[model samples]
Target: MSPVFAALKERHPNLRPQFYMSDCADAFWNSWRAVFEVEGVTRLYCIWHVWRAWNAHIMKVVDDARRSQLREMLLKLTQASTPHAFYSLYNTYAEIMNSKEYMLKDQNKKPRSLANTSQKNMSSTTVANCGLVSAAWAQISLPTCT
Candidate 1:
């Protein structure tokens, strides 16, 4: 964030940074209003923290099959033009992968590492790069003129 701001400042020498942002939520909200009041820019947290949080549940539900499905889902469902669609797909996939059946897949089976099986090779479908979503959301967003 700082680097981007610095580059922007260098290019537009008239611009000035009003505040710094860390991951602290208190600091962000408390200072955000002041920063935007002084300059039009507001500092905030990136998707990294959100992604980390969502992935914790993903690791639990991950198996080989679900992992493949997740990768493909992210590839297909995420689009810049439709943030709603992207988020909807995420919520839907989260539901499927976190279902009772999926969650209980290992309760009865003994933990065995099979090198060539889906059980061993799969990651959860939930672990995805937020950049994909961000890029997809960058294009003219779909109208929700409601």
Candidate 2:
């Protein structure tokens, strides 16, 4: 990847990308910074990967109805076209996830609250650790790459 980036840079010294879309991989990000050297590039993670990672954790929700609801909320979040819409959906999701009705049981059947989880893990940042939806929507009106 570094060699490819180096070659591209060598071929087009003026080429600078505004946005880069990739899966949530540390190596890819590192290469993008260290090798690509595009100062203002906005890194965007694949929504599919983010959804899959969140789905894994959401599957642990004890109630099937709540689990399905959470999935729908996540889908809506990813599809949000504006920052306001994204944040509104996110707040609703957070409210429900933090509610007592959304409790998860331990191996001993003890109720466990996801409230103890870090905000980063509980929110959309769990997988990508980046504000994927909000950031992407913020740039919705930007000109597309040719």
Candidate 3:
């Protein structure tokens, strides 16, 4: 265990550790997974980084109106409490993008289409950690005695 955890455990013996890691290269994830596996620590990718990646994708969209609409939907998807709700919003966005009514082009001025399976290939991380820390952090009344 790290010294930080040791100190915190001294005060709160029942505390549990939840590790949040950004999705990294295969080699880095392999090494990290091995170490954390032995320690029995649960790990998840930070949702903040996931949201940033989504924003980057939105910026690549050529049409201002479509970009704004997608951004709005992205915010709602991130805020969804259940996986069903998230996917519902995601599918809605995908349908709009793929529809003939919503003619769109890429930043390169070439025509583009939204592929249903393409989103899976765009990011390295799938599982996102959103509420893992917030509730715990709110309850901790740590003294900033340093």
RMSD of model 3, in Å? 14.6
lDDT of 1 at 104: 35
Ranking by TM-score: 2, 3, 1
Report the alpha-carbon TM-score of model 2 versus the true structure. 0.63
lDDT of 3 at 45: 38
Q: All candidates' lDDT scores?
A: 0.39, 0.52, 0.42
Model 1: ten consecutive residues of lowest lDDT: 109-118
What is the C-alpha lDDT profile of model 3 across 48-76, one tens digit per residue?
44455456655654367677776676567
Best by lDDT: 2
Task: Return the TM-score for each candidate structure.
Answer: 0.33, 0.63, 0.45
- Model 2 misplaced stretches (Cα beyond 4 Å): 100-146
Judge candidate 2 at residue 6 and give its lDDT. 73
> Counting only residues 3 or more apart in sequence or on different chains, how many pairs clash (N, Cα, C under 3 Å) in candidate 1?
3
Clashes of 2: 0
Predicted candidate 2 versus true structure: per-residue lDDT over 24-119, tens digit per residue: 555666776776666776566565565554565556544676677767876776555555776787667656655744434321221111111223
User: In lDDT terms, how accurate is model 2?
Assistant: 0.52
At residue 130, give the lDDT of candidate 1. 31
